[model samples]
Target: MGDFIDVEQLYDLAMTYSVKLLQALLLLIIGLIIIKRLTSFLRKRFERRKLDPSVRSFLLPGISLSLKILLGISIATMLGAEMTSFVAIIGSIGFAVGLALQGSLANFAGGLLILVLKPYKVGDYIETKDHSGTVNEIQIFYTTLDTPDNKRVIIPNKELSNSSLINYSINKTRRVDFKFGISYDDDIKLVKDILNNIVSSHSLIIQEPEPKIVIGEHGDNAIIFYVRVWCKREDYWTIFYELQERVKLDFDQNNINIPYPQMDVHVSNS
Candidate 1:
């Protein structure tokens, strides 16, 4: 009889633990679903706010991880596990992992600075060191660029943040500077008039700032005329190539001489 009573108590104990375990599992499953939905909601909110891509990329993962950690703690508590020791162990592990990833930590910090400071953003044409391209993506550790020739470049965020970079797309307009050389004997007035006409005729060039055509310098073989014009950033390359071709063609048609280096050497033997 006593053995039967003991068996009944044992079964009750096992049943109680089984129920708690199932409850813990259910809580974990529901918690994960909530975390996923919450993270997605936050991501959409960030997109609506027009947050920087880098910031959004860094933040979403962090939010998910933080929520999961909290959920894990809650699950452990529900399972009758001690919280203090579990948190301490987690902290120790995190510290050890952080110590092992110093370089990665620096990159993470650099990425944060880039997002906050707004040095460059996705779709911006940027040049850093010797690499120049359009920024395609910015992540926690690297920035991806699409080069003019369709090459993909991956630059480390740490190096990019520390170095100087030129963001060419920051402004809506750009100035195109061209230097043309003509023979020293060429008529200065005629050259200026020809350039002015070309500038006025070009549909891409802006007239508000006014195109500048002036004698810049006198070289050994030619006179240099500096030409400056403003155009929309999108039209810069087109205008540059067109201007050069048109100027050369017009100069040739008008009988203007573009001087090249020539040496007249005479030797006398006595």
Candidate 2:
């Protein structure tokens, strides 16, 4: 009779524990479901804001991980596990990982700053001390570039953030300056007229600013003419090359001489 009474008590104990276990499982499932829904909602919200791709990519994963971690702690608490040790273990692990990946963490922070500050964006042509190219992609740790020679460059986010860079595509228009040297005997007024005609006839040049032609300097063998013009960024290179070719051809046809550097030396017996 005593053994039967002990068995009944053992059965009641197992039942009570089984109920707690089931409750814990149910809470875990519900928490996971909520986390998934919330993460999805936040992702859609980010899309609605039209956030930068790099920023969105970085934020979504972080948000999801944070939410999942909170859910895990909640499930652990539901199971009546001691919170103190769990928290300590998590803290220790985080500290160790942080120490091991200090450089990576700095890069991640720099990337976040880049996305928020808007120094340059994809498709912009940028020049830094190390590289110059069009920005192809912006990742969490690195920024990719496509060079003019058809090479790919990967620059660390930390380095990029720490240095100065020039973004050429930020402005819609750019000024193109050219210096041309002609023989001192060449007529300045005639040369100016020819240059004005050349600039005015170019389809790519912006007329609003008005192309400038000025006598810049007198060199030892030649007179330098400075030409300044404005054009759309995309047309800059085309106009640059075409203008040089046209000026050379025009000078040849107009009997203008572009002099070369020459030195006159005299020696007397001492």
Counting clashing residue pairs in each candidate, in order, gives 0, 0
Q: What is the lDDT of candidate 1?
A: 0.92
Whole-model lDDT for model 2 versus the true structure?
A: 0.89
Give the Cα-based TM-score of candidate 2 against the true structure: 0.72
Task: Report lDDT (Cα) of residue 103, candidate 2.
Answer: 89
Query: Model 2 misses residue 48 by how many Å?
Result: 8.0
Name the 10 consecutive residues with the lowest summed lDDT in model 2. Answer: 52-61
Tell me the lDDT of model 2 at 254. Answer: 98
Off by over 4 Å in 2: 1-51, 54-87, 262-270
Q: Compared with the true structure, what per-residue lDDT tens digits does model 2 show for residues 1-270?
A: 999999999999899878888988888888788888987898789789887666666677677788888888877877777799889988999999999999888888888888888788878899999899998877777888999998999988898888899999989999999999999888988999999999999999999898899999988889999999999999999999999999999999999999987789999898
**CA lDDT of every candidate:** 0.92, 0.89
